[model samples]
Target: MSERLKSFIRERATALGFEACRFASASAPWDAGERLAHFVGEGRHGDMGWMETTLERRAHPTAMWPEAKTAVVLGLNYGPEADPLPQMADRSAGYLSVYARGDDYHEVIKGRLKILAGQMAARTGQDVKVFVDTAPLMEKPLAQRAGLGWQGKHTNLLSRRHGNWLFLGSILTTAEIEPDAPEGEHCGSCTACLDACPTAAFPAPFQLDARRCLSYLTIEFAGPWPEEFRVATGSRIYGCDDCLAVCPWNKFASGAREARLHAREALNAPRLADLLALDDPAFRALFAKSPVKRIGRDRFVRNVLYAAGNSGDAGLVEPVGALLGDPDPVVRDAAAWALRRLEAAGLA
Candidate 1:
């Protein structure tokens, strides 16, 4: 009966557009919680204080909900048409991470998860709850246990079928569905992801220090960044893709099948000058439904200013300088630093 239920859920998930769907025992004991405690203890999470606050609840699925007996993990591939690393070489243009270049995955995945959860409840007569990336639930570890993929050296899920480009979502339920065998790590000796990091965010294999991660710096950190990170940021305005793009496993990957997950033409490689000119309303309009919009206009422009400073494009000086008197102190401070950088490059 449990095996039949699992098969039914998997088939329904595929019909609803999930590329991979598997089950795992939610109540099983694991060491993922201890590692998370150590990550928070070492202050590796950077400005994301939520990790510390939710530490206990994130220890396990049952920690958050005692009734959860099974986890139905789902994977949606968002692979780009081509490698995104080369786009960074065009320093005059801003590089939004491949994931952020499309519609926000949280909004895209959550709606489908609700639909699936409803169907699962009807079939099994069990209560269900869904989670995307927002909640305290540790979806990646659950996905690994469910055989969706194994967490790689870069600390993100990697799959033989989807490679480095799968977006994870989970449904925790009271149903005792049969669980799939867990996947083992396939990244032997290869350090492509670790070496590719511009900021050296990894302290060791399978460990990440979010403090130095460009994704955390651009999207999470609110204040002016230390000078070193600004210079290291290059033209990446929203998030960095160096670690994910260079993975050798991507050879097996293909472009995203979902049209909404495809990169918008305007966001592929936007001009730094044009991005530096965005006000609150303009930024919201330009980034509507984009994950980049969550950072707000000020932070987004601050990132663009760093990119502008690194660009060495003389045409951007006027736009960068105009932000000197902006209302946000962070934006103003970034403008001052960018102007100095431009002057140092003899471009001002």
Candidate 2:
């Protein structure tokens, strides 16, 4: 029965275009929970206070849904059609993480997870629950322990087959299911991911300070960016993937098979100058399906202006300057900074 159920889940996952699937026990690691508490109490999560509330549930899957006995971990590959790093070399063009460049993964992956869950329920009349990253579940550790993959020094999961370009999702089931043997680490002695961090966000291997993460700064952070991190931010307008992209193991990753995750032609090399000209309505029309939409118009513009300031493009100054008097102080302030950058760079 264990082998049969495992085979069943693998077939469904591959049919759904998932790159890999593995299973683990539903219980969370107490040491992981303790480390998380220490990390949060040390103020590593930044202003993400919600992480502090779900201590027990976030640490263990059974705490959230008591009936869960097995966890099915799934990964979907979204590697780029080409090298995504060289785009940053342009410096004047803003860079977005390859994973977030197309449609939002939360809705896409969650909808697929639900269908997969439905299929599992049909096979065995058991209760099931699903979670993408939006949930408080300890998905990375669970995936690592489940033999899906090992969490590398940079803390993202790595696999011999899928590498680090995969999006992770979890399904909790009450059915008695067999777990896969956990995978081992291949990071070896490489410190490329650690040295590449622009803000030095990682104090040690396997840990991250969200407060210094560019992804958190450009997206989740609600107020003014700390001036200290501004220069380091450069032209990255969305999530940072330096650590993920630099992993040598990605040599095994194939380009995205799902067309929806394929990089849009318009997004491949967008001009920072053009993006700064967009008002809210323009921003909405352009990024409707994008993860950036969640940050809203004002916040998105704030990020654009930061990129514009780093662009060193003469054309961006006037467009960014036009936002100086906008109602939102955040936009207005960022625009003023962008204008100064244009002048300082002798591009104005």
lDDT against the true structure, each candidate = 0.94, 0.85
Q: Encode model 2's per-residue lDDT on 1-348: one tens digit a residue.
A: 889889989999999989888899886444677888888889998888889887767767877887889999999888886668878878767788898778888877999899999999999999999999988888888888888788888888887777788889999999888778877787889988888899999989989899999988988897888777777888788888889888888888889888888877767767887777777898888887888788888887788788888878788878887899989999898888889888999998
What TM-score do all the candidates reach, one by one?
A: 0.99, 0.97
Candidate 2 residue pairs in backbone clash:
147-182
Residue runs of model 2 more than 4 Å from their true location after superposition: 28-30
| Residue-by-residue lDDT tens digits, candidate 1, 219-319 | 99999999999999999999899999899899999999999999999899999888988889999999999999998999999999999999988998999
- Among all windows of 10 consecutive residues in model 2, the one with the lowest summed lDDT is 27-36
Best candidate according to TM-score: 1
